[model samples]
Target chain A: MATGSFATSGADLELVGIQKRFPGFTAIEHLDLVIPAGSFFALLGPSGCGKTTTLRLVAGLEDPTRGSILIGGEDVTHRKPFQRPVNTVFQSYALFPHMTVLENVAFGLRRRKMAKPLELAQEALELVELEHLASRKPTQLSGGQQQRVALARAVVNRPALLLLDEPLGALDLKLRRQMQLELKSIQEEVGLTFLHVTHDQEEAMTMADTVAVMNKGRIEQLGAPEDLYELPHTAFVANFLGQSNLFTGPVLEATSHAIAVEVAGTRVLVPKARARKHSGEVTVGIRPEKLRLLTEAPPTTAGVNTLGPGTVTDVSFSGVSTQYQVDVPGADSVTVFAQNLDFGPVVTPGTEVWVSWKVDHGFGLEDSASEEAKFAPELDTATIAVQAKRDLAAELEVS
Target chain B: MAFAAFATGTAKEQAPRRKSRIALLLLLPGILYMMLFFLVPLVSLVMTSLQAPVEFGDIGEYETAFRWENYVVAISTYGEHILRSFGYALMATIFALLFSYPLAYFIGVKARPWPLLQKLMLVMVIAPFFISFLLRTLAWKSLLSDEGFLVSSLKALSLMAPDAHFTGTGAAVVFGLTYNFIPFMTLPLYANLERLDTRLVEAGGDLYARPATTFFKVTVPLSMPGIVSGVLLTFIPAAGDYINASPQFLGGPSTAMIGNVIESNFLVTNNYPAAASLSIILMAVILVMVVVYIKRSGTEDLL
Candidate 1:
């Protein structure tokens, strides 16, 4: 909700009406952003959603087709990459193979003709806890070490802005988790603007002070991580940030306090402000973890819990939590998550159950399922993000 | 349990040994070919270089002996030719590098957005090689004749005296070497630069290196494998090339390279020991120079 109220005195990175078209494809369109100085900002989106393009534009590697790029209130749209006060830690960790780790970290300072390049480079290496590997070439280091060296290389410059394009994407799951905390601490220690672009929602949530979910060359949603997760403005954000069970319905009353909507023949009340669309039709959404499942049907109370009559279709136990899919006639399957604090009568697949959640937890969304159908053929978009995350876990098996 | 662990560990170690044995078997042909054609010839040449020439015998005959004086005699007799060969080869290698870097960079990097243009330019670079270089050098001989269009144009421009010609000059031979070996230089350079991680260069620039500084500090050093190979490909052969400096071709007596000296000693003069000694000397000098050059360039892993 608070968009432009962080770190007012320091240099803020601003993008105004930026558009970039590559030949026949438009990578970015009418994009606007304000990354407050000294705050960690993340651009989270699937591949080909313009997140990387936006990062490149900020890094001065790619000039926007139209609109301006301002770093620290200075227009650097026309400047070359070196002239801009920005640095990028590329996804591949692109540590210069030919240079020693120390030389790689010292390169930026040496280019700036700063004195005591070695000392500053050593300090930067120590920040990443990789000072001992200074004499080794980049190829000698493991993937995680290379990643930290790249981080040190970019952060050593002390640029007004540091751009990281999937900085931990190549590391193992355990290393990535460790680096996420390390990176957050490093950002805090440096007190400089860090713009991280990643497709992993957890990474964004774990590190960024603000997360902007980008899709289809535009900003789909931008807010604090919890806000975006709990009250997504669109079905895409609902599905992307985490799993959401969508129930399509017609809006019956757009009251000031709550918007009444009929879902699966059951009347549901959503917080009025949460109803992004006040029109006739809206998609009702609830997180699986927020829903409660009961074996016996309960009487529905107005302005309270909304209950849907259904039969449990599937029950899957995953150690910490048990998930259930309930088949409600005339509606999609409703999913509910139950934490295993205590065991009771197990809900079997053929048993009748009631899926209920609080009124405030249910929110209305502007129809994004139609957009999903239109862009559904790009299903690998989902698999790619999932695969990249899964690949980290798989890499741990190798080590 | 520990015995089983040791057994499995030893089995795992032996598996790679078997794999490497297969790898060595796969390399057998190459190793045999090198030993047969290259190693044998090299050893024979070194022995012949040390053989004493016919003493109070037939003019062209020689006997096998440990005549360490052959090297001294060969160096003293063909010192100018030896130095000239290396100088010309060095100049040609430098020219090839200077000219090929830009051309290769253009074809491989600049023209990357246009696949058709890249393939076309590569073909054009290679098209000249289809015609024999001997014929091309011969064509150049005519083109640089006193009355040829090139010579006439040069005369008109006053860049050359009207009576002067390019056919037999040392410049002509060096030019010939550069022209003949340009493709060798360009292709490898193109291959290396084509696969160059543009991201690394971008990273260098992002780290605040200017474009030119990046070219020297990053681009040039990264492209070193190509440079080392290209220089070796051009310089090694150019140092021992007879065709470029033969009197009938691009050069006269003053431009005689070690190859020409060897050819004359073997074919015209029929002094086989002198010819063999010169060839051995040329090979030894080139090997030393290449090792020193590769070391100086600071990339021993390239070799």
Candidate 2:
């Protein structure tokens, strides 16, 4: 659909075995990705997870140590940033401070010697709804306004792909939420391959059609947001995408359709399709929201897993949901998020409760040692998981 | 009286008042110093600029009279010297800016990855300050003398006439001024460029600007404040400099500037009124030029 003049059919971007290394560390370790034209794709990860590095490699700001980058079957690996048909909306919204908003928007067009730069820039400003602030310098505008100008500046070029490196990071919570929807709509309106890099999982889930969970310079999982949230392949993906209550156990029996795993002296069945590793040891995981917290022991139902009859250690009340931490005898403390559907007396600390979930909801992760060997050559999985958890905790605190 | 009222008032209400009193008290010494040193001398100089030579008195004697025509005589007698001084200063300022912008960019932006190199280069830029300015100018005088290695080599290479020389010329005096004020121009530019956000340059490149285009459009415009300050720092003192244009230094009598004229009038001819009027004119001209320069640069809001 011809929504506006800025709409142009975009070309797909491909990164073939790209690797980037700094002086003492490797930022990206063999990244291979292909973003389809006109798709909203997000590289979701914690800080320092190579997501931004990947974006920069595509933008031609940094050269890959070992592989080629292609845009629409053109090898642009050795080209300069200006020679490549890519533009970036930087995390700091690096608009030229000396120029007015219109001038900043027209910068790329003017550099390319395009016709009617001012008209195109004004149209782009109107697209971002900042036409009234055209004559004002960048410093005169607020952070959100500057962010819009940066977006308009990059979008006005109609590059093959648009790179957004945490573009909403500088905005407040309210403004960030508002801009997330606006950015998604703008992507659709322009129909360009938009590659967004962010640490906020919620932003990635809400804005992108496909989210690639990245960790420790590798892609942990790539799929639709719902699929990734429902069936994570690694502990990093399961814990980082959202809170996952994981239990390390050995596989007692494996069948074509299911695997019976013994977790904390209790048998839990996982669907064969959901478990990445069905034979040896595995870490079974279930989302906190999927598990139910009941005061009595759950009945022995087929195709169900129950893990508690334990004491409630803590209770936290947020507006929409109440979070309960239950301590079972065999398992460590488990987190359960209960919806605020009941108006009765809230559950207090030191009360007994049982945590239960359907077997279909459980997804199994391979043993940590093997997972570590698969991703990194030297380090173990514990260190990466702890780092990811710390980063996620810091991100949560910031939000 | 205000301090006494503050002390006697209620403690809660008078605390802010007492603090303000202390702040004013702290400013007393600076105010006294300015009044005694700057304002008093400025007023005396203005008075002297308007004074007349004593009637039928000795050469050095002058009387307190409103002879404003002393300024007219000063300008008429040394109009060419005043023009040459400004022209040399403008040339020196432009040359220093051209030399320092790249040096500062290299030191502040390119050498940033190796901070030790950045610091080392900055120290090198300011290292010439350790020697006395007069001694340095005198050294340059010898280096560009008729028989010196530079002139001799140029003559041998057929690049200059056999009888040509470097000293006793406008170019030599301008070169000396430019050399002496280079650090002044470089440091401010370095500080400004060091604080510039390099991502903006990268953004320029990402937006289809070539490297040269990015340097001109993104880097230079953002460093305008530095350019303006460096120009002022170099031009103001270069205009009033006497050492470079003194007959014993790099220049002859034909190439004398306003500073040398004022010096000779006060020392040799004992024309105190002429010297004082020329000094006042120099100050007024510099003030007007600086105001216009700052206004044209559009950095008045920064100050």
Per-residue alpha-carbon lDDT of candidate 2 for residues A1-399, written as tens digits (9 for 90 to 100) = 111233267778999999999999999988899889999999998778899999988888898999999997889999999888888999989999999999999999888878899999999999778999999999999988999899889988888788999888767888787778877877787788889998878888999999998888888889999999998888778777777888877899998999998877899899999988987788889999998888888789998899878899898988788888999887788999888886522679999988899999999886452354454432223455577789999999999
C-alpha DockQ of every model: 0.47, 0.47
TM-score of chain B of each: 0.89, 0.93
What is each model's TM-score for chain A? 0.91, 0.89
Estimate, for each residue in A6-41, the C-alpha lDDT of model 1 and write its tens digit: 222325899999999999999998899999999999
Model 2, B83-114: lDDT tens digits are 99999999999999999999999999999899
* Runs in model 1 lying further than 4 Å from the true structure: A1-10, A344-346, A375-399, B1-58, B63-67
Native contact share for candidate 1: 0.85
Write down the TM-score of every candidate. Answer: 0.90, 0.90
Find the candidate with the highest TM-score and give its number.
1
Query: Candidate 1: which docking quality band?
Result: acceptable
